[model samples]
Target: MLVDSHCHLDFPDFENERDEVVARAGEAGVGLLVTIATRVRKFPVVCAIAERYDNVWCTVGTHPHNAAEESDVTAEELVNLSEHPKVVGIGEAGLDYFYDRAPRDLQARSFRTHIEAARRTGLPLVIHARDADDDVAAILREEAGRGAFPFILHCFSSGPALARTGVELGGYISFSGILTFKKSDALREIAKGIPHDRLLVETDAPYLAPVPFRGKRNEPAYVAHTAAVLAETIGLSPEETAAITSENFFRLFKKVQRPSMRSA
Candidate 1:
């Protein structure tokens, strides 16, 4: 049983035939799926999916690309929205210097605000860092200074230094389909060193789908491919990779209430 720790089933890419998309996820052995958030103002859409699926959960956050538009967001609003049972975490939020669609300052502040909200709420912070490794690590270290909160660096494609920093900070590391790419030898090596207890897997679907499906629009069902490559990368059986990562997901996202969470 695999758990895709991060995905976006709420996106329109799966809109017309979401039932099939979800059914495919189950058929692929994806036992649990977490629908991530990109816009807090539009959270009702994300929440509706989590509320509908017994095996799905969600988060409350604004992606860095929308930082300027949602600059007025407060931790209180995130906290209030996160009180729902299905809302298990906070933010797919973090620095994204690669795009810079949002001002760096706004992104940093929004990232910290999500961190603070996670600290207050006792929920894991689902982070998204892209070409902003130093800034992201710095902010996480600084926030940890104030008070340590649970966090997972999702869809990680950065260097080993960032991975080490996250592990040293007692945070979790999640790899996406990017790891299955032909040029991801270095990433595969880095993933090999991640402590199994702190390692996670995600699809980040409708985005970086793994090889064999890389060019197509990704869905939760493809997470199994990522898991297979990760297993081969780490020299474990695919079944073991599923069990280990699923356990890591539950350990990191403790607030999530899934039947597997209890078993793991």
Candidate 2:
């Protein structure tokens, strides 16, 4: 079984075909999906999707782009909201200097707040780091100095330095459809150096689809393509990639009950 560690299922892009998309994921051997929340205010919409599907789970917190608007969202509120059985992780939040839609300072502050929530809740934080690798690394180190928290650098497209820093801090790195791009040789090299136990796969669906479907809408089903590329990059078979990443996912997001391990 495979797990698409991060995807925006609540987005309108999937509204009409959400059910079909999920069914396809199952057909494609993806046993689990985590629909990420980009806005705390619209969490109900995200949580509802997870609630609707036994194989789906969700995370709560604001995206860096919406950090300013949801700046009022506190760590305590995130902790409280995460008490829901279906909400298994926290934040698709981190610095997004590439977009800079929100103030960098506000993004950093929000990132730290989400870290605190992850610390408090013991749920893995799904981090989004774009062109702000330095700040992201610094904040992660500083926060780790205070107290360690679990997290994954979701849809990683940063430098080797940041990847090393993330791995050193005991954080997992999830590759998205971007990994399958022809020009991602450098990314692939970095993946080669990462410890197998710390590696994961995601589709970031409704966005960056893998090679064969690069120009189309992505879904959890396409995570297998990303996993395939990751396997090729790391010299593992596809089945090995699936088992390793699924193990890594359950290790980090301990709140999630593995489908096979759940009570009938």
Candidate 3:
């Protein structure tokens, strides 16, 4: 079985066909899904989806692009919300200089707050970094000095320096469909070197659809394509790749109970 480690099932993209989308994922061998939170204020909507699906779980933190609006969100607030049974992670939060949707400093502040909650709650931090690798690395390192926390660089598309730093810090690196892009040879090269135990795969659904499905709306079902490509990149069979990444997913998101998979 496979897991789509990150997605946005609550987004309007899946509004009219949410059930169909999830059913397709199950048909495609995706047994679990974690729909990420982009805004703390809308967390009820995110949590509702998780509540409705046994195999679906959720996080409770704002994305970097929406940081400005949630600048005052406290670590305690995140920790409090994380107490919910369905909330399994702390964030999809981090720096996003590429968009500059929120002021850089504000984004950093929000990122650190989520880090603090992750440290306090012992939940994995789902980071969303772009065009701010240096700062992301520096902040993670600095925070580790105080106390280490589990985290994953979600949908990673940064430089080798950042990838190396994240792995060295004992964090997982999750790749999205972007890895299957024709021009992502360099990204593939980086993927080849990551330790199997520290590697993961995701669809980042409703965005970054894989090669064969490029230009189409993405869903958890498509994570299989990303996994197949990553398997070839790392010299593992598709099934082995799926198992390894699913293992990594459960390892990092410890709050999630690993589901039983029957033998064929």
Q: Give the winner by TM-score.
A: 2
Among all windows of ten consecutive residues in candidate 3, which has the lowest summed lDDT? 255-264
Query: How far is 148's C-alpha from truth in model 1 (Å)?
Result: 0.5
Residue 9 shift from truth in candidate 2, angstroms: 0.7
Error of 2 at 66 (Å): 0.2
**Which ranges of candidate 3 are over 4 A from the true structure?**
261-264
List ranges where model 1 is wrong by over 4 Å.
Answer: 260-264
Give the clashing residue pairs of candidate 2, or none.
Answer: none
Per-residue lDDT, model 1, residue 13, is 93
Rate residue 4 of model 3 by lDDT.
97
Instruction: Assess candidate 2 and give its TM-score to the true structure.
Output: 0.99
lDDT (Cα, tens digit) per residue for candidate 3, span 115-168: 999999999999999999999999999999999999999999999999999999
lDDT of 1 by residue, 1-264 (tens): 899889898898989988888889999999789999999999999999988887889999999999999999999999999999889999989999998999999999999899999999989998889999998889888889999899999998999999999999999999999999999999999999999888899999889989999899998999999999999988999999899998888888887766844568
Q: For candidate 1, give the lDDT of residue 122.
A: 89
Q: TM-scores of the models, in the given order?
A: 0.97, 0.99, 0.98
Q: Looking at candidate 3, what is the lDDT of residue 90?
A: 96
How high is the lDDT of residue 104 in model 3?
92
